[model samples]
Target chain A: MTRLVVLSAGLGVPSSTTLLADRLAAAVVRRLGGEAEGRVEVERVELRRLAHPLADRLTTGFAGEELAAALEAVHGADALVAVTPVYAASYSGLFKTFVDVLDRDALEGTPVVVAATGGTPRHSMVLDHALRPLFAHLRAVVAPTGVFAATDDFGDAGLDDRVERAAGELVALLSGTATTRTRPTEDERLADPTPFEELLRRAGAGPTG
Target chain B: MQLGIFSVGDVTTDPTTGRTPTEHERIRAQVAIALKAEEIGLDVVALGQHHNPPFVASAPTTTLAWIGAQTRRILLSTATTLITTTDPVRIAEDYATLQHLTGGRVDLMMGRGNTGPVYPWFGKDIREGINLAVENYALLHRLWREDVVDWQGRFRTPLQGFTATPRPLDGVAPFVWHGSIRSPEIAEQAAYYGDGFFHNHIFWPPEHAAQMVRLYRERFEHYGHGRADQAYVGLGGQFFMRKDSQAAVREFRPYFDNAPVYGHGPSLEDFTSQTPLTVGSPQQVLERTLGFREHVGDYQRQLFLVDHAGLPLKTVLEQLDLLGEILPDLRAGFAEGRPAHVPDAPTHAALVAARADQEVPA
Candidate 1:
C-alpha cells in the first residue's frame, strides 16, 4: 500500500515543474509495477488555487476541512516529491508557508526529491543550502538526484530527460534501488532513540490540564 | 546563525553624483550583492519582492532561482513572498519544483505585503487582506503536505479529488519564517503552527522587535513545538559599510535622502540610531549585527539590506567584498560564543540525532 505523493508549488497554468512532477509519478508507477502489493496511488496537490493560508491563527488548530485530507495524504504517503520555483534564492514563500502548517515530523523518514524551474541555470544551489535544510529540519529523507531546469535548458528532448531522470531517480529511491544521499548518514539518522520516544510520549500527553 | 544580504533593487539618481543607474544596472547590483554575500561566507542571500516604480525585483522567484544556480554553500531565502495576493497553489508547485532543482537549499519568509493597492490589482479586497492571508496560507499548507485534497471554501473553487503536482522534495516542505512588522496576530499565527517568526526589525526599534519575538517564543512553547528559546527567529536589518564610518555616511547620504522606502522620512543617521539600520564600517557592522542576539535571543537567520537607494553596482560589489571578508569570521565567532541551550539549525541529522537521544534510556 505504499503511495507516492507529488506536491506542486509552481506558478503559471502550464508549468514545467508540474510536468516534471507528473513524469516523476509515472516513473514511480513504472518502477513499482506489479510488485506493488497494495493500491499504489499517485496524488497531486496544486497550491496556488487553495482557499486558505497554511499558517494558523489563534482560533485555528491544525484542523480544517480543506487541510484534513492533505494532512491525511501526507501522513499516509510512503514517498513524496515537492517541486517549487526558486524565489529570493530559496523555495517560494508559498511553498515554505505550506510546510509551516504541517507537524514538524510530517515528512520524518519520508523520501523526497526537490525540483525547480527558473530562467537561468545559476540558481541550482538553492536545492542544497536553502530547501534541503528545511526538509532536513523535518527529518525527511531527500533523494540525491534533485532536478533543476532553467528556461534555456528546457526544449523538447532535454526537458523530457530532466523530468524522466528525476522521476526515475525518485522511483529508485522509493523502491530502495537508488542510493539516496539526501538522507543523513545512517549513524546520523540513527540519533539517540531515547529522545525520540520521549518526544512521542510528550506528544501523546498533549497539552495537559 | 543564518546570515544573508537582501536587495531592494531600487533604480535611482545619486543626487550628489547626478547619475542614475538603469533598472538593469540596479538588478545587476542586486546580483552582485548576493555573490558578495556568498564570498563573505554568509549563510543566505534573500531578495525582496516589489512591483512598482523604482524597484526592479518584480519576479523575486525568478531572481532567486537564478541565484540558486550560482552559489554553492549559501542558503537562499526570500525577505517577503506575498501570501495574501499571490496564489498559494502556484507558490506550492513552483517551490516544490525549486526544491528538487536546488538540492534542498531553500526556505522563505511570508508576508501580507505592504502595498495596499496590490490587492485589488489581483482582484482582491484590501480590507479583507488579513482574511486572505489566513485562508490562503491554510490551503497552501495542506497542498504541500497532502496529495489528494478535496478542498472547498472561499477564494478558490472546490476540489473533489485534486492533487498538486511535483510534490515537495523528500515529502518534507520548506521551512518558513512569517515576517511581520506591526502585526502581533501574524506572530501569534507563526507561533500556533510552530513556524519561524521573522520580525523584519528594520523599521522598528529594539523594544518593539523584542516584544514581538517574546510573544512568538512564548506561544511557540505553549504549542509544544519546543521551549521558548528553541523557537526559530530571523530578523531584518539595513546596513551601509565603508572602512571609515564618516566616509560611509558621506557616500550613502544622497541615496538615503532620495530613496523611495525611506526617502524624506527620518534622517538616515537618526533612523540607523533608532532602528536596526547600521551605516558604518565592516567592524561596526559586525558589532552592531551581533548585538541583535541581545534582544532576539539565539536567532536563526539574519538578513541585511545592502543594495538599495540606487547604489552603483561597483560600489555595492566593494561593500560585498568588505562584508565577505568580515562576516565569515563574525559568524564563526558568534556560533562559538552561542549558549549551549540555544537551538541550532534544525537539520535532519540534528532532528534524528535529537530523536535518537531522546529514545535512549537515562
Candidate 2:
C-alpha cells in the first residue's frame, strides 16, 4: 500500500496552507484512482500542539503521545507532504524541533513533497537553503516539485488553478512518473565528463577518477 | 568553531530555593542574553519559537529581525523554522525581507514541529507533515532562484510565471544548517543538499550525537556536497558557569531538577554526566565544549541553552556576560587549533562566489 503522510505546521485556523495541503492530498487521491486509494492509507501528523518538553530538548523527556504517534505515522508512510508557515524566512522552529526529535533514518527512501505559506512571496529561497536541505539530510527521496503560496494567492480571486497544477505535479513526482534524473554513474561520468566536471569535483570528487 | 546561543525565551526562579520567576521577567531577559552573546563574540543567536503557555516567543523571526537591527555582526538564526504547517511562500518572502533588513546577516534551520493539535488548529492533518515540507520547499526554492517560476506541487497550488518579489540579496540564498537530534532522516535531508547539518547534542550522549553527525557527514559526501570534514556541522549543548565547579553545580541543580522539561527524572549529576549538560566553572565549560571537536570533528556552529528553566532574565544576562567573556577566546583558540582542511561558515559572499563560478558563459 502506498501510505501517505501529511504534516502541517500552520497556526491560523482556516489556514491557507492547510487548505492547500488538503487540496494536495485530494489531488494525490484523485491521481492514484480508486485502486491506489483503496490500498494506500493516508495519515496526517500535526506538530503544533505536542507537549513542549518532547519538542524542546532543554527538558529531557521522551516524545509525547502526539509526537510519538506522528513519528509512528511517518515510519509507515511511503510518501509524505509537509507544510509550514514562513517565519524568519525558513520553516517554523516548532516544526523544526519536532523534526529534531525523530530518528534520523525514519524518512529514508520515502518520497516527499514540500509546501509553505507566508504573508508575502519574498522568502522563496528558504525552500532550497533551509527546508529542502533539512529533508534531503534525512535521506528522503523528495520530489523536484514544490509549492509556495503567498497570502495574496489565497481567496477565490486567486490560487485555484495553481493549487491544482502544483498538487497534480506532486502526485506525478510521488508516483515516480517524474523521477529526478540520476547523477551520471561512473561509466557515464567519464563519458559525460562535460556536465560532471564541476559537480563531481565540487562534491569532493568521486572514485571515478 | 561556530559559537551558538539559543534562547528558550523563558524566565526561571532561583534553583537553590526552588523558586519560580515571573514569565514577564524571562521575556525581557532573553533580549539581554542575545546582546551579551554578540558581546561575547558568539557567531549566532538562534531563538526558538513556541506558542504555548511557558514559552513567550511565538514569533521568532520578529525577534531575530529585531536582533538583526540591533546587533552589528553576530549572525541571527532561529533554532527551528517550522516548514510543515507554515506557508513556504511566506517563508520565502519574509526571510528575503529579513535578509534585506539585516544586510544579509541571517540564515535559519528548518524543522517540522512536534505539536499535533497545532495541525488541526491550522486546519491540516497530522499525517502528512513530511510531504508538506517536501512540496512547500520545492516551490520556495524555485521562487528564489527562477525569475519566473511555473511550479506545481501537491502541498501548494502551481505557479505559472510567478515571481516572488524582493528577491534575495544579490540572488544568493541564505546558508542553512539542518538541525536534528535523533533523526537520521533530517541529517540525510541536509546531506542530500550538500548543506550544513546540525546535531543538537545537549540531551544525547557523545556516541549518539557523534553517530548522527558522522552519518550526515558521510551522506553529505555521498550526495556530492563535499568531503566529510568539509561538510558544515553544528551542535547544541546546555551549560551553567561559575568560578567554583561546586557553585555551578549547586546553583544549577534546582533549575535542572524543576525544569518542566527534564524535572522529576534523572539526578542532575546523572543527566550532566550522561549528556552535554555541563554544570561547572567557566574553565570547565570551555574544556568540555572544546572536547566536542574530538567526537564531532571540526564543526561550524555550537549553540548552548541558557535561557530556560524559568531562569530570570537577570540571571540569564549574567550567564551571557560570562559566556561572552570566555567564548571569544574559545572560538579564537579553536580556530587556531583547528585543522586547515575543515570547511568554514557558508557565508553570503561564498554563496555568490560559488554561483558565479558555476555559471556557464552566457
Strongest candidate by DockQ: 2
Across A1-209, the per-residue lDDT of candidate 1 in tens digits comes to 55777888877789877776676777667766633555467778776654342432111222334555676577556788888888888888878877877656667878888888777889988878887888889888787777787887666577666666766666666677232323332223222122322432432343333
Error of 1 at B18 (Å): 3.3
TM-score of 2: 0.63
Model 2 regions lying over 4 Å from their true place: A1-209, B11-25, B359-362
Chain A superposition TM-score, candidate 1: 0.74
- Candidates, DockQ: 0.01, 0.06
User: Each model's C-alpha lDDT?
Assistant: 0.73, 0.73
Q: Write candidate 2's Cα lDDT for B1-362 as tens digits.
A: 66878866654456666666566555556677888888777788888766665677778777788778789998888888777677778888888888899888888887777778777776666566655555555566677788888875655566788778789999988877777776565676677777787777777667677878887777778778778889988888889998888988887887887886677766787677777889999988888888888898888888898888766667777888888778766877678777788877887777888799899586
Fnat across every predicted model, in order: 0.00, 0.13
When summed lDDT is taken over every stretch of 10 residues in candidate 2 chain A, the lowest stretch is A188-197
Task: List model 2 lDDT by residue over A15-99, tens digit each.
Answer: 7767778777777766766434485567867665663545334356544345567876776576788888889889988788778
The positional error of residue B302 in candidate 1, measured at the CA in angstroms, is 0.8
Interface RMSD list for the candidates = 16.6, 13.5
Off by over 4 Å in 1: A1-209, B347-362
